[model samples]
Target: MANHAKAAEYNNTSISSLKGADRVRKRPAVIFGSDGLEGCEHSVFEILSNSIDEAREGYGDRIAVTRHRDGSITVADRGRGIPLDFNPNEKRYNWELVFCELYAGGKYRNNSGENYEFSLGLNGLGSCATQYSSEYMDVTVYRDDYRFDLHFEKGENSGGLKKEKCHYPHTGSIIKWRPDLEVFTDIDIPLEYYQTTLRKQAVVNAGLTFELHDEYSGETFEYCYQNGIVDYIKEIGGEKSFTEVQFYATQTKGRDREDKPEYKVKLEIAFCFNNEINLLEYYHNSSFLEYGGAPDKAVKAALVYEIDKCLRNRGKYTKDEAKVTFADVQDSLILVTNSFSTETSYENQTKKSITNKFIQEAMTEFLKEQLEIYFIENKAESEKILEQVLVNKRSRETAEKTRINIKKKLAGNVDITSRVKKFVDCRTKDLNRRELYIVEGDSALGACKLGRDAEFQAIIPVRGKILNCLKADYDSIFKNDIIVDLLKVLGCGVEIKSKHNKDLNTFDLANLRWNKIIICTDADVDGFQIRTLILTMLYTLVPTLIQEGKVYIAESPLYEIAVKDKSYFAYSDKEKVDILAKLRGKYTIQRSKGLGENEPEMMWQTTMNPETRRLIKVMPADIEETQAVFELLLGENLSGRKSFIEENGYRYLDMVDVS
Candidate 1:
């Protein structure tokens, strides 16, 4: 133990002692795992896991996560606090020891059969790993009438807890850590990402209050869901709902199906199928599968099969009926499945719980029992819902028919290729090197094409104001020439025809090829509208493109300052002010009303040139919040969009173009 302790000690180490960030560079994976957003998410996961573990141990209820002003993070929890003691002979406090030492925590007591049972930080290296990866870590502990504090710099203990006696004391733990700049090359934490996952956690752990503050943007939010996943389901499926029914089931391991080795499996699932187009499925831990595992698969399969069987018995489903896939089941359904296990194993680094195979069998039976009772008790309502399913079946068939016609149009098997002539496509087939600039008008398109590297950049000019496909259906979309051309260029294959020869007119989803899709419309109101239209279509129809980071918005300079023989570009009003101040000599300031205003050379220099162009990358901070906003803005209802615009339009409106 002494040898191990001595080896773990980095007593003389300092931030300056390391060579060129090698401290974090040497063990990059130990900190973020990899150098990307995933690693950044892993850091967040570590903090969240620690907080959740504290909550699970009944030591904390309130956890506060703050995005510090200095690209750091502080997650403080009201828990029993990290232990601080010494092997009187070792002459060190346990809390301080834990801070610098790896594999040192009560979470690993499972080997000893200690009371510290389940936890999110089972590896016992979570905090230590964080400390080692961070440039600095401040840990303060208040527990059992004593207060303890410790600080570390670049994986080395910089200071120790003060031994002074205190007048008052509280019980909790606070960890403030700054991921070493040397470790993580990029530092862009989106508040929405944290909000989404944390809010979900609050819902999964009923009564667990989670608070988040983004000092960068002066934004803060608190989440506390008393009803847990039940409320979560209701939130997602707002107006899309059916008969409200909650099921509670418990099955002792041996008494139930003799499938696997376990003591007991207990869980609760709440669901209500609605008329909405999307399915809302929430997974969890603690009576919920945090990262849905085998149990989720088993439950879903059983429910769909049972629904098919029950409907068939009632003469509602035909034997030759197309088997409704999971995607079909989710068309208008909101489901929350909670599977609890005495022993839980995570599938990946994010610690998404996936343990116990028999859980699926157990959950299947539970869902069957509850759904059966529900169907029997509400036979009329169930039958009505089934009728709705039949309607979906018809709509799907119609949509499928439309799909075939579009395929022929896209495949170039007929004269439909003429419809795509408006697009100025690049000759390059290399997806990684190719980019598309959806310019507003012919003038901007001409400038972009002239300024672009013809080898990879493609320019497509929209004729006047483009059609807004927000509320448009497949038929409406298929009729629009602009949408058809864009779709054909994107390589999202045309819709295939049904078995029966019919003009279904559907959009094919396989033809998309451009890796970098930039919406380079002007910075004015019209440009904003065009951008919105394109985003709405892309987000609604092909979301994976955005998810995969293939979409971006080009930042065109609003102000071009030509002083003497030199020219400078300013993207924002503040930048213009600063640049004008820097160049005090006589100068001519020109405001670019739109992309069309810029000459080909100026356009390339300021917006189209890869070497100098500025681009805004969209990232979600609070997924749930984003979803709510998207629904409010782009949903079928006009009231939500109107109310949202009324409340927040001022901030969003481009004042420069608002005239």
Candidate 2:
């Protein structure tokens, strides 16, 4: 009886509910999805969505947002101002319903077209929830030749509602609020967030202008896309696109189920296939979908189906060839999808995605029909797209095979004694003290090996000019025995940037055997070419080695000055000039011979000795410019190469091997 009495203490009265503003102020993540900076940013988006909805409904065309220096945000829109007076039907003031209540707004009767038909803020929770989560909020509305103002602090009404008659040029609302520090752990939204969000909104909402003012930076930015997604697609595709931009738009009314009500849907798709650039963006009701749900599925399904059907009809695939996938098409495709629906089934209140079954079905069917017509009408474009997508597919498959083979070939402990040919390793196992010298040939390698510190220095010889990695494919480049042996000697695996070859990315800096990888080549045209080829191989396959400051160039003397009983080495013309100016006795100057002809003492003093030799660290600060130059000189850029050679060929006239 005593145990039963103790348990019976938990009764109906024990069940408590959060009341008024406490409902949202206490558990903010319940509505905003988090209590961190993301939630604070979503709160700002919630307010901005209301303004976007008003502008999208044709009530306005311009919206202004401001990021105040004091951590407040303001969103002002030129639209039909929010009603703040009394409501006869509900027998409550509109101010109370909009500012205090949670689920109260004018967007519910969307199908009737009385309010917002296709709205971004349809849940009726944005305005009130944002107000409740604010430390202080000031709302100003201009309508009916009257200006109404309301102020709230800490989720409570302050000074009630203030109404005054004034002559205003436009009817709209301006809301400035500071998110509460107590409610959220972080509220410092960055300017980049606003720029990206407003740009995406402008892309979806055609002809709507969004102006952002950052008081912290004292700068203003404007985003307006007159042609909407079409313009965005062109901007993303740039001049590298092979196909002209294609735009398709349609609207339909449908229902997910017989029991569900029918709603209207509008879809706009803009796409182009580019060789150098690719992007995929999806938006619904002006909200960018970071995690695309329905439209993503629809696009993938329709494109694969239509493209595969076209390829089969044209007999482009062999008997045993596999069908293309979305990845294959996506490799060169730049597309943007903007869609809206009156009755949306959002995945959550944050509104990152929608799960409406009818929307997906409608979009998929519409895209399939349009694509079939497009392929039939534009034969040239269809051919180009088909060829490019096939190339991508075949390349992806080959890369996959190459990745698997390379992983298997390069995996395991690098036993240099038996696996790597002619790779002389240092006696020490300490990576910090070890060095690897990549010399020109076997003769140069013999000289370097004889002169180098055997306790810490190792030597590997490149037979001749290895494969030009910048101009060759991965399979062809890796097939070279010299390159394979060099990589095996280095012990650190390669890094491949392709998504298909991601699994083959076995590079780990800790696995590198040497502290310094010194490229030691003769100072001649052929040696320069050999050095460039070796550097290109490292740049393409093991870029991380250069980025981590592990690669270096061993400077070989260009001139050897023999005087009395001493010889001074000069690596450049300036060094030779300085040395000649400092000489006090009769001396004979002679151009240095190749590394193969150098004596062991000369090699040690000039190239192998750490205390006397000069090494240039290969920095990766201008890596992009280096890559562009490499591509122009060796990769597939014939016009660029021609232009560069024509403009700057004179600089290297002496270095050219005319003989």
Which model scores highest in TM-score? 2
Candidate 1, RMSD to the unseen true structure? 15.1
Off by over 4 Å in 1: 1-33, 87-93, 110-117, 167-169, 249-266, 277-279, 286-291, 353-355, 413-659
What is the per-residue lDDT of model 2 for residues 419-525, given as tens digits with 9 covering 90 to 100?
A: 87788888999889999999999999889988889999999999978999887888886778899889888888998877567777888888888999999999989
Candidate number with greatest lDDT: 2
* Model 1 C-alpha lDDT per residue in residues 195-247, reported as the tens digit of each score: 87788778778799999998988988999988887887777767757656455
**How well does candidate 2 score on lDDT at residue 649?**
91
**TM-score for each prediction?**
0.60, 0.90
